[model samples]
Target: MDKAKEIFKVTKKTLLLIAGLVWSFAGFRVFTIGLEDIINYRGNKFISILVGSVVFYIFFKFIFLKMYKKHFIRITTSGLDKQYFFQFFDLKSYFIMGFMITLGILVRASRIFNPVGVANFYIGLGFALFLSGVLFFISFSNTKKIKVQ
Candidate 1:
């Protein structure tokens, strides 16, 4: 029974990871198209990343604070030997989340202004968010002795 439960948990988590990848890939292509049309200046890209971080942070507040806060406490205490916690949610994750969210939101908002790149951005952002959820699960699994999700 325990084996079956473990198998089910792994399967569910794997499915979520795969789903996240597929959604993000599809959305990113659409976002690229939207950016080509709406982004008049390169500076907007950086601003978008910062905005994405805040957006992603807000979106996951519940899980981050309520469910996974203890993991963070452990990581901070674990020191360098267990630094994978830091690595799992490393700089790359943040930048990717930022870029994807920015592009997706830009796409959605541009619908009002009728920019060429606007629609794709929203689709992409939605998918990027899906991926972020998967990453959260992955990060959590890595830090905890048992599957917390």
Candidate 2:
């Protein structure tokens, strides 16, 4: 268990990615890099694609990992002796992941406002939907076993 914690600490890609995503989003433009070719390049519409991808990718790594642990608790609660913070964290992550997924879908679906490349934007949103759906389902099952202290 300690080793796994150490690994999570060392492999902080998710944290970095989230920070990067937030920064990128604040600076995003409708066609910062795609204006040159509105048809294929999508003009400024690609910003949504990149934002959704980066945001969802971070959630895939961190939020989904939390759901996996919650599922593990459900499948086999043998060794889980009514611990503390685990329960709260799992619940919190569950809802947050759901929100992220919903937000990603909205961001991608908003491509219509950009004037081009709606399909590419949705590609990123699709991954978020899939990742969030799996994680939420896993966590939902674990909710039944509250393991009260």
Candidate 3:
């Protein structure tokens, strides 16, 4: 059983890489979708894009950056030699992710808000997520250096 469990476990470095890749890919996909929606918007395109850019900057600085730091500390402080593959994110994170995904899908499908408005929000969110992923990669690289030294 231990050997079987080991097959599904991964080192912290690998967890970091996996988290980075997953977040980056999801961010890119969401960002592109927002971009496409904004392109199709008939309103003031420049202002819409500008608003989205501002949102991105604010969220990246205030929210996602802090989240990255917290999670980075958590990962570095964990005592486990290896962890389950899905343990890259804590339980709270998994719940939050699931909720956000469900809400996003429902909102989009129901057209509860203007598509352009949603696009702006998505753009900001996506960029923040992408930046967080980049932070993870940076930490991962630093860990590699630590191991080498």
Candidate 4:
């Protein structure tokens, strides 16, 4: 039991680190490379994109995660007493995550926005989305029970 809890702690930290790294790298690259392109284009649309990305990130990091944590608690009490894992086996989450990943891949792989700063913003946004989805997916593997002190 203690071993399982220890494993969960390790895995959770690792996932969080990986997610942070992914976002950091993507943000760095986007700022350094995308800024120049954005200046060249001289379009104001990048501002909107940047604002939108910030909003989305906040929503996911706060609202979405909170909802998921609640969902996790609910599921843990539903006869899965020995586990405190992520509950993501439902089709809704699958579709939402799949769509986000696919969209990110497509945006990152396409050259249509190469000359625009919005492209870089989207590239970073997509990478973050994909990474977060992966974090959530891996979050489902724990079998540890959360003990109340």
Clashing pairs in 3: none
Output the TM-score of candidate 1: 0.33
Error of 1 at 92 (Å): 32
| Model 2 C-alpha lDDT per residue in residues 17-90, reported as the tens digit of each score | 33234323422332232332344652455575676577557755775455545644443353433333233234
All candidates' lDDT scores?
A: 0.45, 0.44, 0.82, 0.49
Q: On a 0 to 100 scale, what is the lDDT of residue 80 in model 1?
A: 39
lDDT of 1 by residue, 3-97 (tens): 65444333323333443454446445654654554465445665555554554456446433332344333333443332321233346545865
Model 2 TM-score? 0.31
Q: Which parts of model 3 are misplaced by more than 4 Å?
A: 145-149
lDDT tens readout by residue for model 4, 1-149 = 88867554323333334444543454445444544555566568657467547755775586555545554444444443333223333457658657866765676578565446455454444444444444444554453433332
The best candidate in terms of lDDT: 3
Q: What is the TM-score of each candidate against the true structure?
A: 0.33, 0.31, 0.91, 0.40
Residues 28-48 of candidate 3: C-alpha lDDT, one tens digit per residue: 777888889998888898888
Top candidate (TM-score): 3
Q: Which stretches of candidate 1 lie over 4 Å from their true place?
A: 1-10, 39-113, 116-149
**lDDT of candidate 4 at residue 59, scale 0 to 100:** 53
